[model samples]
Target: MRYKGVRFCVFTLTVFKFVNGYLMTKSPPRYVDDYDNSVHSKGKFLCLFLGICSLSYHQVSTARPGLDLVYQWKQLEFDYQSEYDRQADIDMEIFIPGQPAPIDTDVYYAANSKESKVFVTIPRFQSGIPLTLGTVTDKMYKGNPVIAPYPSWSWHRSPKTCATERIVSVYRVMGQPVHSYEIPSRLLEPRSILVTPVIDIRDKQCEDTFVYIADCQTYSIIVHNAREGTFWKASDKTMYPYPNYGTFNIDGDSFDLMDGVLGMAVEPYSPGKDRRLFYHAMSSPTENFVYTSDLRNQSIFMHDPESSPHLFHVQDAVKEVMDGILPKKSRKIYEAQYDTFVKWCCQRKLENVNEDVLLVFFAEKSKTLSSSTLWAHYSMLKTMLNVKRNIDVSKFYKLSAFLKRKSEGYKPKKAKVLSLDQIDKFLLEAPDKDFLMVKTYRGERRTQSAAEAIDKNGVMYYGLMSDMKIACWNTKGEYGDRLYSDIVASDSVTLQFASGVKVVKNLKGAQELWIMTSRFQKVATDTLSSSETNFRIVAGKVDDLLFGTSCKGKKHITGGTAGGGYGLISTPRG
Candidate 1:
């Protein structure tokens, strides 16, 4: 059974032998007598490859552009009872068994809404397929669905010698219109305008509906305001999967898993309340959420109803500009610095934040933390005070000079990162026999809360994100990929979040990956739902792990006799 159909107009040419129809207009019924069979065979071959099967209620116009597809509701499969019926037909010799087991070539659901029948097609590839098209009925035999001939069994009862009622083969079920579902003209018309591939579409239902589309090809999330028929790129893709990240070790098996945005859901909200849409990359072990209301506030790509809205409150606009000057990570650091000042003021019963109060705060912080750190506080508070309280701390010349004098001879060390090529060349060219790593590397300045485990090779292993990512790096930040991640590592649903990791060595000195997970995000967000055991530990051996985790390798290192440089995961002190 092949799901191939000729268009309504082409029907006259193929089925009716009308040559003067839509195709090759000639005298009507160009085939004379026995010539009809030749035309039928020719038409059948033409329909075989160029597929068409119309199940639509009406002829869909081909005037539009791009591809359009009907959503599949379900996959049709026969229950066990149906298989028994086919076997019974074989036993009765009413049908011959196919040499190889019948292969379900195609499937189609009954179009009638109330019908409980699903049809499966077993093509006559060999000989054993009993019927071309049969229905998997609602009736079950021995708690399994059963199959029967479509229309009636009589259709398949006739002998091949002179059979008219005998069901032979079916090309298609419904009438088709010419190229009704092919590439639409509208899509092809603006081929130059569309750049990104649409991979996912989700609806945000509100008074004004908006469709959130995820384009994985370009790593962009787009918002389409359905009411206005306009769309714009959004989110800046901060939550997208990072490069060289995403491979996890679960029980020592490494899996690359999936990539791109595959999961998306819009949270429900009350009529007057704002909703939140949650989504994340399929390969990612974390989730990112944005307010639905924020999506409605389109950028220049979509809406410009009031082209340029006046900045009514000058101070408010100034504050936003001031806030924009701060880096993402620095904002929280600045707020913490500003918060300490307010706390110090409260402790002294000082209400107003002025020069005198600031002088004392820095004076106190300078005594314990470094002069460099004091300068840090000064720089952050200068903008923090101006943006939050409209007070410019930079104007205090005496305070600024006092701090500047303390740092007159000091030089701050800058962080350095070796390029991948440089690191790779060094690893390959530098032999382990010539160099020896006798001491643990300690030049590290980066910090993360996830507890870490150091392997025998001096590579530190750690857990990253809720995806239960077991990552390892030989100090110089050489690796960030994970060992394993799945639903158990999801932050939102599972309380047992991947957090701390350790490489446990047994009495036999065999090493294993051990991880303890906790709901750190839940506590941080104040969304902790339970108070049971807050920890879950997952453990697997290094030797048994797959995907070349490098957990048990000698790492270009052999026994060395000469003294070597200090081996650390951090930069050299010099």
Candidate 2:
């Protein structure tokens, strides 16, 4: 079949077929020239034709390009600045919580160039009552609301809110409406209102509990107790009386008495407990002294006026004056003085009081500056007491000695001489230092000016010079010549050799020996040894060297002689 004015040719064969349409011309396969003998040749040909058709269709569809389309997602935004400007024009009525109605107010803009103002109108009630604005009290900022405590008014910041310049207002009518006039700065935003409850401690009976309040700026202490209150003024005189109590004289003027100042109360300790109320009263501009008041005995005692006119010590005397009264700065001074006095008394042994009292005083005083003064005072007192009592006072003397030693300067005791065996052990374990020197008798020497350890037993040292030279000594007991010439020597040799030593036992049955050494290293020597030859000096061989049966008599012997070669051999004579 053919259409669209095109002719169609169709041919059919058992092995091949062709169809020619109006769009294209078809060719028929010749069985003789193109047909394969394979069984699937016909199927392969059909498949190839179908693939070509499909490829052509796809190319034609893709080549026809129309309009392109793209899609993307975007967020929607509103003009916040425009909205803010619009809202700024509208007048919003402000009303406090738990109030009746909004009050008419005028909004004032901040000092910016923007002319911003809004007239807030309050609607009238149907009852025909005239509206009155609440009295504007004070302004607050941030969380702090300016609260006026007085009637006409002084303003204080509210403790709860963080706001600046809060206009605190009071209503003639109870619970009237409240409103803010305008928002000035960023800090003037109204958040919340706070009402502080009034408190009166005098109306309430608080037993046993004590209250203390201090003026941090003035360093004044106000103490209040349950029973009564006393106010110890910052001045010399103690004002306000409560109960019968003792009075302590401080610097002959300032008296410390028990009284509660402000709301705090001071409490007294139990009787017989050796409790005392002490005060460090600052008298005049620069004068300060300690006052003590005893609560148990109702007596006040001051420190010895002669010893310390500027300082006074009272023992348990402060307690009577300030017991049940809040302790103040004055009380502390008094207590300190009492402690000082007690320590002084005990240290001097003036009054036969219990030692525990002195111990307690010292222990308490140790917690203050008065402690150092008390220690010095006690030292002096102890010395004087010992002299008066005719006591040994060695312990006190030793303490003074230690303190004296420290004051002068600390000097290390001289190092003791080590035995040959000790020296060997030390050298074996000790590390080497550059300052140390080691020498051998074979004329080999190694010198380290700062050595940590040295072995000197194997070397025979002659005489030591400032330059660490080894010099030989002559029979005249003088340094004769340089021995071990040109050998590395140390400024300080640690070893020496003594030849031809003589030992003699004097009439006191004591042996005394005169040792003539060719060299002397250290000024003090506690041990002697020989490097070579082992020989012992028999005790009975030299009767003069032998002491009698009495060991005490041998100590008086002045001289002794013994013979040995190379090595040290100790022989005790009976």
Candidate 3:
């Protein structure tokens, strides 16, 4: 869901088929207003729209949902009369004389359900697409519904150019222009220049007008005032991907395409929490629900309660606890990278914090640093700049590509663990009764070597039950306040025991432990399913109560002196 990675220009268009079935409704293709779908006496329906293909309407059975399918609609092949007419003037032969019809013409660009008709775009990216845009009719060709050109057949007489007189081979049609909104990279920082994150505006008939946006990358719900164009990164990280369990195994090809926060809906004609914004990531199996009032309320995003309500939390210890969405253990490394970038900018008297500055900064560092180190700085800076200076560097797609190019032939230095022979030798020769327990564990547990999955501060992170929470150990050798609240799920995504843990050491650098949580229990019981979360990569901070020392080896990386450090040193501008 990265901006640089989403290569498609045109997006999906949604269509709503009301309970009566005869009442088809279409709003602006890009941002449709939330429709109220009341359950009727006719029958309850379950509507499923493809990512960018056809729509299937299902009847939610009185027995159980999805138990019985009453009807399913598919798009049939077009006659190509419009394509033939459109290509006649351009001297292009429209159809081969009795050309074999496409084995499957199910591929469609987008769809909009208007009154009485469902409009669809059939991209002429290849042949067999009879028209650029058309309306689905009740008439069936073969067994599926057939499409007729919209407006009339005359409107689509041109090629893909979309010239003055023609609109054939079209993909961007049937969409009403909605106001563009840009998400401010960082909303928590003070100096950020705000931009609109508005994506969908509520119906004007409603008393309060709210703009809703789905930020796929950041996993945030952006809310804005439609009239004023003011926006905030609301419900940030409230929408996230749950690791899907199984693969799509057909007659034998297994495949999957991962996506995030693509679908959004605003529940209608209800008050309080029932009136909600419903959304889901395509990669996830569960739908996220937040009250429309929570999304509409500006108070939640506006409040900054670090330590006290009135005063700023200036104390480092408390500030470090609450003012972070990142690993508190790596706080110093993050700050160091930020200070270096800001110092470089100050030395050059540069004020504009944008892609150009970062590109040059990273480019210079790339000379001495390996690709991993270069990326390490990039990752650190991306978060730190947003946290400290309110700068969002992720929108710099060019920089991302540049760093990717720089990493073309580079590889990370693998951390060295004990060889099996060495392990065996130590097991046989080493003299300690404690080694018995180690050998027993190696024999019992799946013998995955756990590296120093702890931090320099003698603190470790582990998951707790009852409420999905993560508590850390204090220097006093007892569990302190939970540092992080892990994502709670009905499934044991976070509750499952960690399969493996590793610190993945960087030479003389601050490190955080990585916890690999998997439902091996599901695999054991043959209950694994793609419909639910089964695997997850979680970070767990580890601290020791036993020896008053964490598992992380004592290594502090200062990167030597200014001249010998990460990048070239620059003198401050006078």
Candidate 4:
């Protein structure tokens, strides 16, 4: 009886395998043999084997390996690129409010190891490749559907024009719509929104609160209030048909009111009982701050949000105002114009009220030319959040300008030259390991040399003062054992090394060919090569034409006079 039972089970298994094999063999191959020798073929086979095994033991094996998931993700990147490219036009236009979300919206989501597992395993059981797996479309999870990698709502707003959707909405995982509120038209439209992390404020464990700043006619709009549109001025606060805007017109000295606010940050961990919000206007060098408790009130914000009550305060900490944070090094570097710096400090204390102090580095002018400028700018940015006092930005800039002009006539002392020993020591300790300095010695008279060229074998050729004298330097970049200097006979000399030959063309006469060594050293040839072709170019009559290597490694060779002609010479690799 036992033998009979084992035989019957074996026969049943054999028949099941035979039927499945017959069905699989009848279908044409889904994968092509064109990639049989490629790396992709190996991957495809590995995935197929794993998929088959997974199906057979899926009930027993509940967990997938991390590496398997990574391989699947890499494959998906290639597959999704084509899908995204084909649907770009449609995807770009689907960001409107109350519309169907784009398929690639999950790109904005924060990644999860758990989600990665779903990406690898779920598709193996499906019939075809998944268009939306390992993505927010897998509706099994909840809460802020891993904030989509590319939020669909972001497309509705144009940062250039500050135009955005009127309605603001929230969503859970899987693109499930939650609560959405339409902003009242009477309030200042949100040019940008910043949210603070959850914290204790107003005696309440306040969750993240949104901070919105108005999109005024500055920077992005690039126009004045009168010309661009209606803006509220302190002088004219009468209710206009539209909401008020900030003005940053420095030429007219009208920066008293809040102009364009650009920079903003929130204190995540505050030592004080109240949380603080910090911001600064691009039009003025003034910093301002307010308690989060006062700004977070729904009633106060809904009615008159623009007119921030007593909660708003100018930045002032440790009696060390904007001047304390200004770049001191800039005063020495820009001796004549250092006082012209528009100075203001934006201070923020993050870790504790007095612990991690962040300050904004002040700029001397619109252009920052030195490390001093960058240091001051970055340091000030670190501290701007905790500033406690309002500043007169216009008055400060105006006074700085006045002081700069007054000090302009006083010439600063010349910088002291470094001695030979000091220069050598500086080079020895230089940070760039590949840097090797070379000195060119021109005997007293700097000649009107046309150009210089270097070759692949470390040979350098240059004209001394006059284009007639062509000299070669060895690998050490000095006139050494391999040095070759010769005065080529020509009225207007120009030489080029290429294609195993050197050609010297006299701008006033005909071109001559030479046998060039592998080192790019020109050797006289008795006969002109048949490969020579006539080359002539007319140029300007400018007497002071200059030729040199540009910072970008291209030679800038110019000729003639006023209407100068330009040409470049490059070293050929051997």
Candidate 5:
């Protein structure tokens, strides 16, 4: 029975193979010898052998090694079969997976296995080209990893080197050599590049063109014209040098034919238009004057000096007072009156003292006072004049009046009582022949007194000589006896005499006595009171004292004997 079963199986397999071969042969050939012509022809032949085996075998094998081999062979066969089936269906219908079987025709084979299997169909005797299996693990083209030696033709060519400097290089496209005109190094280096060709419309020929290269680095704006052959650089133009002038530059706007201009003035007649230079001028520190260049008439027009009207006229009388030519008292009065006049004239405008007018007034008044006083007065005037015109005048008026009153009332103190040292020094320094008088304090009055004696102790004073009158003064400078006395004692006395013969009263008796005066002689005497008085030498000659008879002449005396004399009389023995 096993033998019979085996024979039957073999016969069944044979019959199936015959039927499959007949069907395959009867159908139009899907591919001819061209299908096996590829470098994978060995794989294709193996696939054909596997197809025959599948049809010839009656039982399916599931053993490990057998199943594996069968699986591989089946895979190969399926590939060839799919190719044939694809070609057969190409014209009539699409060979889609899971498609319904065609009615009355078995177009696709249904597998008995539960899992679906995939297959490929190829033709025979195709071109012997190597197929791309998949990506290889290794190399990198540019920065990207590539599967093959060559990528798609769409891949952009990358630059080898890039710099900021300008450079030129040649590139190859396919097998043709392309000449790259000079290109800034700033281009290239990027993954992608955009090239724009610039054409000059002015040129009829298309030869006037340029290539603009842009990359990721920076956008370079260049001017390129075929007429110019290649490219040209475009940048800002250089500035021109300005004109020079010595101490000051010429003011462009101020220039005029008549006026000398140091600066320019620009004026615009309308908006959005060029400015016009109308006047040329130089500024002055003194606002009264403005130097200008006049181009119109070629002559300068100076404003009048008297344009400012705050000026006050100083009266000549007042000027005289300030100049000190007028007496002190007169000057004081004049200044007061002048200040009053100024205050009245200035009124409201007085607040802004016309400086020029004030200056003129000052100059005129300056002639009156001392130079020092003039300066001080001028300074004060200037300060007062600096007050703004808007300021109230009442306050300044009151102040000026107050100042004038105070000045008029001011008085300096007088000195009293000359010191003893001062008197002595005056006497010592005075000529011996001259009558010198020293001032002295007597009661509440100051009186001039003469020095009677200058002893080693201190100065002595007596009557003062005034217009030939002898006014007696005591040591205390009190009014004392009018005539001389034979014996008197006091703290101090001053003496003066126009004539040497002067009468005196003897202290011993109430009787007139005469003392003889002598020139360059000294005498010491003692006498009885009545006898001396009775025999008093009424007009005895004396020198240097009570001797001269001439009122204004020098005195002289001769030696003579006197009655009852006590001290020796020393006279030159001639």
Candidate 6:
């Protein structure tokens, strides 16, 4: 008894009513449209067309539409402050099966609309494609469109203290509803629930269909035989929340809580399967999984409270892979910050590859800037090396270091630090009157000591900044008899104006002391004497300068607060 275009398969006789009872009668050609087209279109007509072709083959086979169901819970654009203005948008999209590429859908739960005042909470799906959705509705709006004699799932606005009610509905493409049920809130608590596929828990009296409901917040999974009117939490520590997995606010607790445990996924299987896995991910980066055998079996988990599932440290997995690619010694030289790189690798299914090409690729793809860019490259290389372990670990590590150092060592030219006399001479001599010349230039800006110290010989030493690195007078002017010139290097340098201006050899070199003499060189060394007006300035926090011991241990009166230097000066305690 076969039809004209019928091709029978193993999966048959499980056809629930077609969504909207819409069926295609005309026996069309078997592969008229491309298989890819049917996958994206929900193949609504295609599924119906296929249904006409064969009575069997109820389930529509979709392509590798990884995570076809996308459920997004977002707050709607409405006044949330007022108790009457409770509004939120829950978007649920199901990808059309057997599509060459994924496509978007107009289908959504119209909870947060002008018509309905129902606040949807805890949406969970059953197994298999075109599954039923169970959602809890807080209440109905006062001015809703529904007339009297209200529907089965319909309820009037109740007292504020009462909990919400649940609404279960089977939805198809384009938000078409096939069947719906309104379960009381008392039967199923609405928050953080994962509903498993219908299972037959038949004993002798009757065949009972049960579902495993897991509440992440309650730290419990309940065995619910809805048919037999029985529900109880499975006595297992495995169902509880991880010690660190809970809600925490980024901004201080002024706003509402961002609940954790995004949701859970149950592996699709026949009614009576013993071994199955239930996967759950908190709001954090990590995801964990537990076996259904332990979750379902009351005897094992109930008694042994210690039994819990293995927790997967996603970042650690990436680190382990990276460790295998680099040598033990090489690991200490580089910082293995490879979380983002590992995530990218995971998404691309890039694993067990050579180090050279991958390392170069990771460095080029990073968005880090300045010296951090080198670290980014190092991290990417480390992660990529771990991506594939086929390469020799020691050889790769050596090669990685070579490539990193070679690329990172290319330093850019440093900016020139002009002497105060040179800058001051340029400002005074430059033809461009607008260059570094404000209206109140002489009144506001003046030469100021940046660093100063008195040597044991009583020579007054000081470093002066005429202006704080203002760009003016592009051409190199004449280098006057400047007090000190700082040589720009790969790192910050310590310059001393003593004798001939010299750069200190080490980073932590002795504090620079400049011998402050008269503006003209007429004053002889023998007759030179420290002035009470000469203030000793010590480099303070970062660019700041502190006025230490005054010259001759007396107060050095200044025209301004340390003149043009922006650095804050500390009062000498002594």
Who wins the TM-score comparison?
A: 3
lDDT of 5 by residue, 1-574 (tens): 0001100000000111121112110000211001111111010010000001000000110111110000011011111124564455444332222121100000111122211111111111121111111111122322222222111211211111222111111111111111234433332223212111111122233243332211111222123333343442211100001121101111111111111111111111222221111111111000011111111101111122122222111211122122323344543443454454365444534433443445445445545755545434543343223221222233444444433443465332332323233444544676746833322211211121111211111111122212112221122111121221111111111111111112211112111111111110000011112211111111111111222111111111222323321111122111
What 10-residue stretch in candidate 3 is worst by lDDT? 57-66
Question: Model 5 TM-score?
Answer: 0.12
Q: Candidate 6: worst 10 consecutive residues by lDDT? A: 43-52
lDDT of each: 0.35, 0.21, 0.35, 0.22, 0.20, 0.25
TM-score of each: 0.25, 0.13, 0.32, 0.23, 0.12, 0.25
Residue 386, model 2, lDDT = 31
What number of backbone clashes does candidate 4 have, counting pairs of residues 3 or more apart or in separate chains?
46
Whichever of 3 and 6 has more lDDT, that candidate is 3
Show model 5 residue runs off by greater than 4 Å: 1-179, 186-197, 211-219, 227-229, 233-574
lDDT of 3 at 238: 28
Question: How would you encode candidate 6's per-residue C-alpha lDDT over 477-509 as one tens digit per residue?
Answer: 111101111211110111111111101101221
What stretches of model 2 exceed 4 Å from their correct place? 1-237, 241-354, 359-377, 380-574
Q: In candidate 1, which residue ranges exceed 4 Å CA deviation?
A: 1-207, 243-245, 248-254, 300-574
Q: What's the best-to-worst order under TM-score?
A: 3, 1, 6, 4, 2, 5
Write the residue-wise lDDT of candidate 4 on 392-480 in tens digits: 23234444443345345544343333322344455566555565433221111122121122222222333332222233332222222
In model 6, what is the error at residue 313, expressed in angstroms?
14
Can you rank all candidates by lDDT, best first?
A: 1, 3, 6, 4, 2, 5
lDDT of 3 at 71: 14
The local distance difference test score of model 1 is: 0.35
Model 3 off-target regions past 4 Å? Answer: 1-59, 62-75, 79-83, 86-115, 119-134, 138-144, 149-238, 243-246, 250-253, 271-274, 297-574
Candidate 2: tens digits of C-alpha lDDT, residues 112-165: 313221111111211111121222122322211111221111111221242332
